[model samples]
Each structure stands twice: as structure tokens, then as C-alpha cells.
Target: MSRDLHADRVELSIPATVEWLLLARTTGAAIASRWSFTYDEIADLKLAIDEFCLTLVEGPGAERLDLAYYLENDSLCLEGRTVLATPGSQAASDSGATGAVTFSADLSARILDALVDEHGISDGPGDGAKTAWLRKKRNPLS
Candidate 1:
């Protein structure tokens, strides 16, 4: 029998706006809790999610954001992507670009480093969409 690498996973998509950031944070908190993550760890996950999501929304003005949460052994992984608009699409015209916008700031990087075990922002598979990801390990003692 083959075991799935991810024991549990959840996917979410929301309009790329600050107004929707609360939902993203809430989702992270809920998933972290389900895995029995400590309260401090859950708070860290929520803050990390908010920071990364806010960067995507505020930096490049993405039209939509896609997020995936994966539960692995003793860790929760989060992957968030900006849905790049197609060339000549209404969204592209509105945003004034078809290529993904890179998100990088010294303060944000430092904050994520402190909050999560591992984190990064990179280009996604197609259309150069930007994707940000993080992994938070459960505290063994907690």
C-alpha cells in the first residue's frame, strides 16, 4: 500500500485584496489547530499567512490569490500564489502587466524567517505567476 505524502490538505482562493486577508488567517489558524499545533505556533502561522498574503496583494496588485495548506508529519506547509492575468484579459489591462510581480522586502523576509521554519517567494509554474510558501513545524514538547 502506498501512503499519501500529505496526510491532510486544504485549498483556498480569494480576491487579492486586504479585505480578504482575515479569511486567510482564519483558515491557517483552523488548520493548525486541527493538527494540534500549540497556540503560539498557530499564532505564528496566522501571522506568516497574513504577511505573505499582504505582500502579494499590496506589492503587485494581483487579481486573485490561491492558497494550499498541506499537513505532513509534524509540520504544516502553506503555498500561496498570485493568479496572473492573461495577456489582453481585463485583469491584465487593469493591472498593466501579464507577468508576475516579484515580492521582496527586507523587513518582510526577516519577519518570516523569525516566524516560520522555512519560507520563500518564487515564480510559479506558468505565466510567471508569483508563489510564496512556508513550512511550520510542530513543537515536539508542546
Candidate 2:
């Protein structure tokens, strides 16, 4: 399906640090609310955002995260991508010398599937960056 060209969209950029995850979640909740999502739906959206953003930020080399919130006709769509720091860069150094961090993809998928209408996590094409996206449809009964 094609997206509406005039759809409302908000973009946010935050440092790829655990401390900044709250900012991402708050932004998502705010946008979701504006779209008239139910409180429980908003909570689910926040949790899904946290899980996906944490997966990116907790890993080494991520310097920042870019998020886009799209207001669709009957749903809210969130797309987040990580910007990785170059090797030996200050940003990379600040991310800590700890080895790669890993998360259970299956678990994450299950959680996301339960929370949103649709979701995906994938590595950006040839960029080494990771992207996570989700769409939550508003309940008509609400």
C-alpha cells in the first residue's frame, strides 16, 4: 500500500544511550495519544519502542538513533534507525569497550507481535545500522 504524502510525521534524534530511551518512549506515547490510541494501546506502543530502541542502543558502536513517527489514517507507524560510530572514533569509544551485545530475536519478535499490529527489525542495507519499525492500528471501538 502507498502512504499518504500529506500524513503527519515527526522525527526525533537521540543519543544511543540507555539514558535516552525514555525520551524515545515518551515521544512515541505522545504521538500515539494524538492519534487517539487507547491508553492500553499507548502503553503497548511505549513498551515496543523501549524494547526495540534498547536493542539498538545497548549494542556497541551505536552513536545515535533516528526515529520517525508517522500518523496514518487509522494507525501510528514508527521507524527507528541507529547511526553507528566509526571504528576508533570518540563516539565509539564512549560506547564502552565491552564486546558485542546480543538479544534474543525470537523473544523480541514475540513481544512486538503481541504489542503491535505489525513490526519488523532488520539491518540497514550494507550500512551496518539496524532499523526497527512498528505499526499500531487504533481500535475502532475506542
Candidate 3:
């Protein structure tokens, strides 16, 4: 069985950084959302998600990035995907790729980590395209 209660889809343009930030905040609000996070925390979430976005966009050329949100009874799942291509089966082997982030970079990532409970990424060559995914759990304590 599935635990999700709701779903949302947002289209993001790679050049529009502000729009990306807005999407991050709105996504946070939609799931495990509370009104008490500090400014730094909010900023961190944007940065972390931005890294996720950048990483997803690095190897492949995406005309537009598709964002998806899954709201479950116990958690909110945030994911992004693009129909870009990678040189190899694993993006890591591709020089065009970059590294994943630690949870200590910004307050927002911390807040997201706290709220989402867990996060992950899975990248590979799929159906003649390269795709990467970033996912976060909705923290119960959040």
C-alpha cells in the first residue's frame, strides 16, 4: 500500500534561480510545514535543493526540469527529474557530474533534513536518457 495523501507538480526553468527558491519554500510549507523556522534555515533548504537541482542538471541538457511532490500520511517526498543524457551508466563516472552535499552546508538543508527525516539520490542511464532524483522524507518531528 502507499502512504501518500497528495501530489503536486511544478515546472522549473534552469535559469530562474528565484523561482527555484520559491518552489522549495512552497514545497516545505506543503508538507510538515510549520511557521517557526529561522531565516537561515529557510535559506539552507533552498541551497540544498539547489545543489540537488544543479547536480541533476549537470550532465544532461534540460530545456525544462520537472518537479514532483508526494505528500504521504507520515512524510512528504520531494523529487525532481529531467530528460537529460549522461555519457555512462553511472553519472559519477561521467566527468560532467559533481559530488553530493553533506547535511551541514546550510540551515535550510538542516531544517529539511530535520523535517524530511531522510533523503536520497539515484542516478543512472534510463530508456536512452540520463536522469537523477533527489528525495526527502517529511520529518515527523517537523
Question: Of the candidates shown, which would achieve the greatest TM-score relative to the real structure?
Answer: 2
What lDDT tens digits, residue by residue, belong to model 1 across residues 1-142? 9665458679999877666879999999998887788999999888888888866665443668899999766889988988876555434324422235444567777878899999888776565568888899999886
Q: What's the true lDDT of residue 30 in model 2?
A: 87
Write the candidate numbers in order of decreasing lDDT: 2, 1, 3
Q: Summarize candidate 2's per-residue lDDT along 1-142 as a digit string, tens digits.
A: 9665436789999877767879999999988887778999999999998887876665566777899999676878888888887666545334432235555657777788799888877887447678888888889887
Q: Which regions in candidate 3 have their CA more than 4 angstroms from the true location?
A: 1-44, 85-117, 123-128, 139-142
What's the TM for model 2?
0.80
User: Candidate 1: what lDDT?
Assistant: 0.77
Arranged by TM-score, best first: 2, 1, 3
Q: List candidate 1 stretches off by more than 4 Å.
A: 1-6, 87-104
Candidate 3 local Cα displacement, residue 137, angstroms: 3.9
lDDT of 1 at 44: 89
Question: What TM-score do all the candidates reach, one by one?
Answer: 0.79, 0.80, 0.46
RMSD of each: 5.1, 4.8, 8.1
Model 3 has a clash total of: 5
